[model samples]
Target: MLPINIIGYRRIQNRVKSLIKGPLIRKVLVLVSGTVLAQGIQILASPLLTRLYNPTEFGYLSVYISILGMVSVVASLRYDTAITLPKDDKLAANLLVLSLIIAAMMSFLMGAGWYAVGDKLVGYLHAEGLKGYLWLMPLSLFGLGLYQTLSFWALRRKDYKALARTRISQSVGQLAIQTGVGFLQYGQIGLLLGDVFSRMGGGGGLAVQLWKKDLQLLKTVTWKKLAQTAYEYRGFPLIASSSAFINSAGLQIVPLMMVLMYGPEVSGWLLLSQRVIGAPMDLVGQSVGQVYIGEGSPYILEKPRSLMELFYSMAKKLFAWGVIPTAVLAVSAPWLFHFVFGGDWREAGTYVQVLAVTYLLKLVIVPLANTLTMLEKLKWQWFWDIGRFILVVSGLELAYQLRFSALQAVVVYSACLSIGYVSLFVLSAAALKRHVSRSENELSKALMPDPE
Candidate 1:
């Protein structure tokens, strides 16, 4: 006979195993495991990185990353997102090619624009240190674009394992280069190079896999098909891309504004805080989101109630998983920063404390925001993005004008953004409800007897 506690433990373990045995949960586990390993590498390296480099250097690196993000988000004109929508693999292949072509063109245009006016722009932004590194932007944009397109292609194919491998490759490549360069005393440029390397690293592996598995599909791609698909999915570029760019800008602009209002050192503190808090949150959200899209897409129109259940279930899981971490950070961020990252970073922890709730809200909402895309609600998404961008920018500007300190400014920013995210959740839920109602109505009509 077993003791009561021992039997209960065994039962709980069995239940856990059974829960994770589902295909959706299993796929999420694979991506989450990869994300944990990859982000863990960077997270573990942060203390060393903090000691190796100073706040100002990290600040410059943050600015570069912000620029890279703003461009990379729209590099494929968001056609990559549409890659998963088509029923035909051949159509998806054409979207993949179209994305690549758009990326290349965007890269060339960005490089040309930089060459024409990079100097003045750097000077105006008070980012002179970034001038030498701006040349890498176009290259990084192209790599990021390539990786995103391939990632969506893999998502469409339900190739979660391949996607997981690419993440590991990116982390390893980034950590190696960044650490080596830091040891060599390359300053912020090392961080910049490492970031660029990260953008490019996983792309080759994804590209190789794509080529080997879909060479026949690739061969079928043609100019006519590309053009036709481009027209077919024009809303992605015109609306979704615009919305994505605005959202990206809203995110990246914070550090840029920090740099402008304070200095690189101040921005550096914010950057570290974001890196520590935001990165893990984003990776987890994104991992869950990838699985949600792959798992939930088929049920969107056919069984919207199933999709709604999945959405609510994912949101609940994310919220529950987020609570402990958010509380820990809210309570202990300052001490944690001082102890782990040295005294210089205690301020960064303050920023984390102020923004902890915002990050938690973001963790829950961002993953499910894909609901908008899945439902073809691009216009609604666009409106929300614009409004969020306005709220963030105006709120920050108000804080600055009122002579609020950096921490206070972050508080205002966080509060405003939290409101925005709450609105977003409501919007998404309403969209899902509307979808469910319509689905139910259609089913009822179909089941009704003919008047004749």
Candidate 2:
């Protein structure tokens, strides 16, 4: 048993090390580096934030983030997905300009909507002071949109080091602001201020990098051409962005609904689950998607077979890496939460344990979903998401009608959502294979020797 274990360890170690020798591995490493640091900061700050603020405070913070998160997608007009697909960087710049124009237009529209409906929006969430800081919504949307664009650019340039630095700076800045606010008894102000400071760090850094890169060549872009270019790959990004908004920001609607049905304290508990379960996701998932999409696109174009094989291999790697950590959190969450966050968050452990399944499963499928964007299979991806949306919405509604416990409802709700995510993985991989086969056939035709 000892010899077998040692051999297994050496084999796994060799495979993992070999992964880093490829260019894609470098991007993945850089992206992972950023996520690691950012996650470290979040881990450091989470205890303080939890202790300093109650579930109600977190609930409010979640709502603000949800609103801003949804609006930021609208602000980008889906150009964030286009940065890597196009062969020409100049064309990509035009896509950026187009995203900015849409962002500006949407900002005006959102600001107007807030002015007219601000009270009701806050009232719906059952929170006060939302109207007072309503102005921050639009400003934060701009910041988020610009930051996303810049991040995409860094991805396209394969500037993962810069990207990682920016992410760390932003995380540190946010933690500082929020921690300071906690000390001053500023309540939700801390959360909001932390967000603002982080975006300033991230977006400002991107702006400086963009200017220095001398991408001024983009200035020559024509609006008409850019619009047409945007139209070409528009379906995936546009639908994908909408689905992300719905699924992501849509989580807030659950807490809001729970609060309306059960009360604020229940809502707070649900929010706590989110923070705990969301930790691994924020720490690693986002970074993996960033690098996988950025680096995978070019690989698919140049060496389709190698990319497909790597995709499967990496999926296994991600699963192996995530499983043990997920299991430990699952087993230890209740005790950890009770000790670190007190009775108010004692249930957080259960939440973490329940949701850890989703994260571990996600490690298997999420990277493969990038194939949808790589192959321009937007319509297929959209269908997958819409199906998931229906399942999730339906499951949640049924859970409520049945008067399920908050814990049961969340677990079931997430299980339903995970189904859709897994479905997308299967569909995206199939689509990529079909595309690769067709490309090979075309190449074969072009290269066949002309025999008499």
Candidate 3:
């Protein structure tokens, strides 16, 4: 006979194995494993980075990353998202080609524009530190675009393992370069280069993997097909791109505003707070999101109930996992930051406390927003994005005009964003309900007897 404790342990281990064997759980686990490792590297390196560089340097890097993010999210005009939607591999391949063409053209235009008026723009934003490094923007944008396009292709192929590998490589490459360059005392330039490297990292590996496996399919792509696919997916560029750009601008604009209203050090503090709090939330949320969309896309029309169930199930799991950590951080962030990131960062902890609930809501809602895309409801998403952009900008601008302190401004920003996310969740849920209702009605119509 076995001891009670030993038997219980065995039973628990078996249950764990069973859960891991489920397809959705297995896919999320694969991506989360990579995300965990990647975020872990960055989290561990934060202490050293803070020590090696000052708040002002981080503030400058934040601005650079913000610009990069705002551009890169729309770099492919969001046609990359369409990669996962098509049932036909050839059409998907053509979409991929179209996305690449657009990314290249956009990057060239960005570079040209920067060369023409980069100084004036930098001056306007009070981000003089970015003037020297603005040249790298186009390169970084192209790299990010390539990575995103390929990642979506991987998602479509259900190649979770390759995506996982890419995440790890990106983190490792970023850490090695940033740490080494920091040791050489390159200041903000080191941080900037590391960020640029991270954008391009894993792109080559993914491209090689894709070409090796899908070479024949990709070879079938042609100019005519590319043009046809572009027209077919014009909604992505026309509507989804605008929506995505606005959403990205809302998220990235805060730091720019902070730099203008407070100072680089204040912006740096806020950036670090966001990084520490956001890194884990994003890793888990994005990991689940990738798996959710890949798994849920097929059920949009075929099994609407299954799609709703999946959406509800994911939202519940995210909330359950997020609430406790958010609560703990809300209470202990100030001390934790002081202890972990050093004294200069204690203020960042306060910001974390203010934003913790907002982050939690975001983690739960943002993943499920993919439903809008899967249902071909880009217009709703566009409307929501526009509203969110307006709310965030107006809130921050009001705070600035009122001469509120940095923390007060952050509070206003966080509150406005939280409200926006809650509204988004409600909208997504209603969309799913309508989809389920429509699906059921169509089924009923099909099963009805003829009037004659």
Model 3 residue 86 CA deviation in Å: 3.5
**Pairs in clash, predicted candidate 1:** none
Model 3 shows how many backbone clashes?
A: 0
Residue 90 error for model 3, in Å?
3.2
**Model 3: how far residue 339 lies from native, Å:** 1.7
The parts of candidate 2 lying over 4 Å away from their true place are 1-27, 84-91, 215-256, 263-268, 281-327, 368-380, 418-452
lDDT of each: 0.88, 0.76, 0.88
Local error of candidate 3 at 292, Å? Answer: 8.2
Q: What TM-scores do the predictions have?
A: 0.84, 0.76, 0.84
Q: How high is the lDDT of residue 46 in model 3?
A: 94
Whichever of 1 and 3 has more lDDT, that candidate is 1
Report the alpha-carbon TM-score of model 3 versus the true structure: 0.84
| lDDT (tens digit, per residue) of candidate 1 on 291-393 | 7899899999788999999999999999999999999999999999999999988999998999999999999999998998899997888889888889988
* Distance from true location, Cα of 308 in model 2, Å: 9.9
lDDT of 2 by residue, 316-399 (tens): 888888889888988998888888877788776877777787877776687668778778776786677557757877887788
Candidate 1 residue-pair clash tally: 0
Q: How far off is residue 244 in model 1, in Å?
A: 1.7
